[model samples]
Target chain A: MSLDIDAVKNIAHLARIDVSEKDLETYTKDLSNILDMVDQMNAVDVTGVEPLSNALDATQRLRADVVTETNKREALQANAPATEDGVFLVPRVIE
Target chain B: MYSNWETVIGLEIHAQLSTNSKLFSGSSIAYGAEPNTQANEVDLALPGTLPVLNKEVMNLAARLGIALNATINKRSVFERKNYFYPDLPKGYQTSQLELPIVEHGELFISVNGEEKRIGVTRAHLEEDAGKSIHGAAEGCTGIDLNRAGTPLLEIVSEPELSSAAEAVAYMKKLHSLVQYIGICDGNMQEGSFRCDANVSVRPKGQEELGTRAEIKNINSFRFVEKAINYEIERQIDLIEDGGEVVQETRLYDAEKNETRSMRSKEEANDYRYFPCPDLLPVVIDDSFIDAVRGDMPELPDAKKARFVSDFGLSDEDAAQLTNSRPMADYFEAVVADGVEAKMAANWCNGELSAWLNKEEKDVAESPVSAAMLAGMCKRIADNTISNKIAKEVFEGMWNGEGDADAVIDAKGLKQITDTGAIEAMIDEIIANNAGQVEQYRAGKEKVFGFFVGQVMKATQGKANPAQVNQILKQKLAG
Candidate 1:
């Protein structure tokens, strides 16, 4: 599938990236090339084969349901850019 | 005026699993904790943090699959649904995309005595995002990551429901089922169980589906019904006014009882979904499935049938009793303690239920124990106390008066079956009410109630009503 400027701009907006007019042409070409390369797998005529979702065919390893971790609010919140009263603060989000 | 439109509804229910820890992290999953106290490094998406799948989530999901009679996929994959929200610490939700864990399930709901089968498309495991507390900080949003990484089983239903009532019934049945299987707590108030309803209206007997709108995060069953109804009417009104229903996500303002568009389709976020690379495919062997099935409790439908045939309860009573697992357990406990099934069912569904409703308590939180109720039922059955006196005793018990016998003794509410005492009262009533006695003997049969009432009043209402009637009838005839 071919990528247009508007489509690229929409994708950039969804990804929360700011795309300028000068970069739009480059982004469209790059995204289209990526899609085309990924679409190359469609050339195989394996209609009945099940699609693979994971690279490793291994089953998922399960952990016990116990609460092995303790409260680390102070340590975890140390990485936040902004925090107040044990909450990570952000710009006001309106519904 | 709009008889040409038909409402079609389907529901997607997100039930938080009742596990102790988060789905993919070791963080504690307890609710109502101090803000951010439950968030660990893994939940915070710190560098080098990896997610480990909890085994209990699989067991719980398998239990739900068995309960719904769904086909359990042996292998299921976890995918990353990418979205930008302040609540999502990882910037993507780990959910099952194309291959859900359970699929092709069906639930039967009765709407106005018409039974319809609602098809369950799939039930997939996903991680919940954190909470964004608005209006808490001055012109800012505060995020609590306590709910982040929590497990949710999103059960999606097919577009089979035709009305608001049907959709509500379908939701109630699914809610009860998940709670019954012990997979979810089914607490809508705390949002452990919430639903998003997809509703659309079309011309009657039309084959093509119309554009649908989704009502999001409706937490109550009543709101589900009301929101669907309001949306249906809105769509019909729009179509009749030469407008088309726009596909969008709407928010149900429960206080106002109306649905307003949250965002139109063009502004909808594209949740670019792809399989997660961190986690492998979840594979279940036959033995694991068998163990989960073996550990399953009796489901609601089976319990309802057993209640009908084993206890000779009416279908309505049985259905009511088995709607919740705890209620069914309470009823069975009362009967197990030697209370007659029919009488026990009556007291449980009647007086006990009424008292519970008044106190706004669930069966599990009932103040009166099953043994206490059985004791009261025994008194009523053996003529120790009349049903009316038992109600008064129940009230006393609820007020912490004591057990049945203590309440009866403290209140002097026992039935008086003494024939000699009843005879004395009857003779006095006959002598004093000479005019009424003459009226009764002259063939005014209704006056018999007057003498019985007087006898009862004289005995302070302790007289056994049947014994009072017999003795009073004999004295009046002679």
Candidate 2:
């Protein structure tokens, strides 16, 4: 089964997207097509095959544990929506 | 009937690896740093940034896995757990889902001197989230990203624990192991080592389990025990009143000693886990594992065994001496100073331990250094100070007088082990206490004690007790 409009709306809400009602139908149709492709891909049975974590045959690089990062507060926090007392401020979230 | 209910407990401990830098970023992992100062482009989750794993984290994880007798998977993958929170600048946390570094380990815990084995389900590497300082602003929370991207190994345990005491034992054992292996600091106050407990109750002999409530962020061992017991009793009482316990995340109110439902965290959605495309899988070869094993420090159990066999110490004394690395080092240093092994163990496990317990200080913070203690213990071993005189010398040393020889010389507390001096003192006592001597000759054997006391008192209580006793015995017999 493909995704429905209501399901798409709930997902958009969870993602904090401003999906208008008109766009909801389009997103539902578009998402359904993507799910249909995924379903087709899942049809192949590979029970004993190990799951692939990466496409590359190489492993990850390891870095020495050292303080290479310096205080770039002025440059980094320049992109934040709000900051004060050297911290990014947001609506209080308890727990 | 209520007592028959079986409680199952499993703990998830998040131990921050004692690395110099963050897990994926080169940002300093030092605590109490000024917020965003430590956050670099990678830690800030900026676009077009990639992550490189810290080699120390893997080595520490391998050390812990080997210490716990866990299997180290050759290949482990990191996944992104999608969630939204202000403190988490990135919309997802990179964690291990399917393949973790360590798996299927077991550790032993002693509860009331009875050891029990608890299974370690798995331990995975993950980055820590930033701290959310609530009410720091008007109707808002201030986020400190200093702790963000810090390396943490989340250790999950099997639900085999039955009681709160057993749960505490398991937590303590894990804590000591992490600290002993030098992977974690085991500092709960600083949030280095944190615990979360999954507790549930079921009817006796029931094959199925009741719904579990997860108590999150229990920072202290005592708090873990208290919180688990409270949750268990609450579940039992709720079921007894025909209520069903729902699966939820609970917050421990340490001030009230209760676990309350955190409906907000519960409302959070499911974490969609997918392998991170930005980072490749971690593949540890045999050489890497061997290197980690070689770097592993001696664990507590092995140290304890060595102390017993090498030093001929009793099991209890060995346990007490090797309870911590610093204490064990002190014990060894004292013995290395030519003190008898038994005497050093006695002084270390007896006097030093009692003093530490009373003053509430760790051996690392002891005012007496190992060399200083060894100096004092040397005097007792060589009979420079008798056992009784050594106490006075120790008191002087504790009061900052000096080391054993200094204190003994400064206070004139050195034992008079000279046989000739002791004989002269005994003769003087016999002549002065003629009546007591007569009583001793007339079969009043207790009079011998009076003469010995006179000798000790005449010497200002510094007479070698053994020598004094022998001389008094010979004089009284004559």
Candidate 3:
């Protein structure tokens, strides 16, 4: 699939990024190249191989269901841009 | 305008696990906490933090799968679904994309005495996002991360439900199943369990499915049915007007009882998914699955069957009693206390259910204990109190007057079984009600009931009704 400037703009908008007219062409080319390389991997014919979902063929390590962490709200939220009444504040999300 | 249309629906339920901690993090999973207080560094996705799979979550998921007769995948992987939302601090949700933990499960639900088997496509584990509290601040939103990392098992069902009632029945059955297995608290108000319904309509006998609109976050069973009905009518109306149904997400307005479009499909988030790098694939051995199966509780279906065969309860009564584990347990406890199974079933489902409904209480929080109910049933069996007087005694028990005997004694509600006293009362009634006695002797059999009623009134409703009937028949014949 080929990428166009409009598609790139839409992708940018979906990613919550602002793309200008001048930057749109550049982003389209870059994203197209990335998609082309992924297309190259798709073109290789593997008749009988099972697809792998993870890099390593290992099972997940399970942890006991216990609450070992205590409340660190003060330290954790220290770097937040804004907070009020123990909640993080952001520009209003209507939905 | 909609006579030719057939409504089709499917449901996706999200049940929050009742584990003590968050799915991957060590943060407490308690609800209604101070904002962000239950969230730890790991839950916030801070740098250098990683997620570890909680063992209890897997166990609970397997338990649910087994209860539904679903195939438990021995191996499953977690993938990151990338999306942008303020509540999602990680910029992605750790969920199962390809291989869910459970799949192809089947559950049977009955609507109007007709049973339908709804197929479960899959159930996968995922982390819940935080809450975006809109209008909490002026021109801003407050975010509570306390629920951000809680575990949720998203159960997807096949689109085989034909009507809103069937969808509701399926949802209720599934809700009770999860609660039966002790995996979820099933509290809709607190959002412990929630449903998203996918609805569409097509011309009758049409094989091709119509585009479906998903109504999201319907927290209660009643709303689920209402939302689907509204969506179905809307689709049928649109189609009849020569308009097409656009696939989209809708929100049900509970107050208005209508579904409104939330977002169209074209503008929906892509949710680019990839296997999560931080967590490894979850692999379960035979022993783990066995352990889950071994510890599984008697599910609803099995309990219903047992209630039927063992207790000789009617099918409807058995089904109703086994709707929840607590009700089934209460019934069993009453029967185990030596009350006849049929009587226990009747009182438990009849009087107890009615009282519970009237008082707006759950069977679990019933004021009358199972033993106390059993005691009352025993009094009825032994002719200590008539059924009518037993109701009065029950009212006293509910008001905390005491157990059956105490209530019976305190309220003078015991049935008088003495033959001589009843005979004297019958004689007095025969002497006083000469006209009625003559009417009764002259082929007016109905007047006997009047004599019985009079005798019962004289005894203040304490006469054993069967004994009164026999003596009144014998004395009047003489």
Candidate 4:
């Protein structure tokens, strides 16, 4: 499937990205090329092939029915952009 | 708008599975954690970082699938959904695109006593992205990675909902089932569970679907219902005005009660969906499925049945009690502590529930113990404590002072069951309310109630009601 110029523009705008006219023409051609490769995938018969949802085919593992975590406050709050004691700090809004 | 335009609605709900860690990382999924503090290098997508799937999340997804009567696929794979956003620390999101863990399940949800079979298209496991903090600065946007990489089970449904009520019903049904399974905590206020709706309208008997818009990130159920209704009307008006309904993702302004277009609808939101090179395909074997099935607690349906048959509760009462696992568990524990099932269910659904709500406390944090509640009921049954005293004791128990026995004793709330004591009160009442006594003797039998009220007031509401009646009747007849 070849990419359409309108399709490229729509996708970029939906993604909240500004694409220049020169870049748009280039992407139009590049996306068409990529879609053509994807079109080849459509040719292969996948009637029986299952679509995968995860990497492992193993059965789901079970955790012991117990709480493994309790406290890690300092560690958890270590990366805040701003901190007051143990809590995160955001910009004050009200007067 | 003609009457024949059938509304086709379906929902894709993202429920954050109640796992301790992220789906593919070791970061804590604890709510209210400091921003970016719980995140590790993997969550931050630092160089050479890799994702390792949390096994408990898989079990949770399967447990939900089993409850929904879905087919658990033995094999599933993760793919990269490529998108660039500040909240998405990873350049692309790892999601289940092809083989979802559960598929082709059906849920029978009842809406106002009308039952409908809604199909579960698929339920897949994925990781949540961090939240973007917008509208804060004049031109700056910040990202909070506290919720980054939390495990999410994306449950998608078929377009079987024909009305907004059905859509909301489906959501409610899913919400209850997930909570019942103990997979998703179902805390809508805390953003643990959320819903996105895909809605479209078409001419009657049209072979192809009409243009549909995806309404994203509606956390509350009422908003979901209203947003769908508003979007449907918007589409109809657009079509009537000879305007094409643009396919796009939109956000609902709940305050405004309207949906505004956020972005134009795309044929696909291309994350350039590709197989993630980092992770391997997940293989689910029978043993894993069996273990998950074994780990399954008594679900809502089974609990409801037991409540009806064993506890002799009505179907509606049973349904209400078992709608939440914690409430149902509390009811059973109260019964186990020797309260009559009917009485146990009553207090649990009534005063106990009211106390929890009034104090904004969870049942797990309830100060009243099952044994204490049962003992309180026993006091009421044994004529040891008056109903009024029982309520007083209940409050004491709610405050963690003590259970029925201790509270009743400490407050001297025991019933005045002593015949001598009650007889004395009755004599005083008969002497004082001479007119009422005369009226009773003159065949105004209803005046007996007035005499009883006087006796109760004389005793400070502590006299046993049955004993008061017996003594009053004997004296009045004499």
Query: Please, what is the whole-model Cα lDDT of each candidate in the order they appear?
Result: 0.91, 0.88, 0.91, 0.81
lDDT of 3 by residue, B48-147 (tens): 9999999999999999889888999998989999887899999999999898999999999888888888999999999999999998879999999999
Positional deviation of residue B474's Cα in model 3 after best superposition, in angstroms: 1.5
Q: How do the residues B141-253 of candidate 2 rate in per-residue lDDT, one tens digit apiece?
A: 99888898999999999999999999888887788778888899888889999999999999999999889999999999899999999999999999999999989989999
Better of 2 and 3 by DockQ: 3
Residue B267 in model 2: lDDT? 30
Runs in model 1 deviating more than 4 A are B264-267
Q: Order of candidates by TM-score, top first?
A: 1, 3, 2, 4
Query: Which regions in candidate 3 have their CA more than 4 angstroms from the true location?
Result: none
Error of 2 at A39 (Å): 2.3
lDDT of 1 by residue, A10-82 (tens): 9888888999999999989999999888788677698899788776667789999999888888877787888
User: Each prediction's TM-score against the native?
Assistant: 0.97, 0.93, 0.97, 0.84
> What's the TM-score of chain A alone for every prediction?
0.86, 0.80, 0.85, 0.55
Model 4 lDDT tens row, B247-270 = 788899999999998754244466
Fnat of each candidate = 0.88, 0.94, 0.88, 0.06
Which residue pairs collide, candidate 3? none
lDDT of 1: 0.91
lDDT of 4 at B13: 92
lDDT of 4 by residue, A1-95 (tens): 37777888878875668998889889998888888888898899889886554456643333332233334546655665754443334554221
Give the poorly placed runs of model 2, Cα more than 4 Å off: A4-6, B265-269, B395-399, B420-460
Instruction: State in Å the error of residue B431, model 4.
Output: 2.6
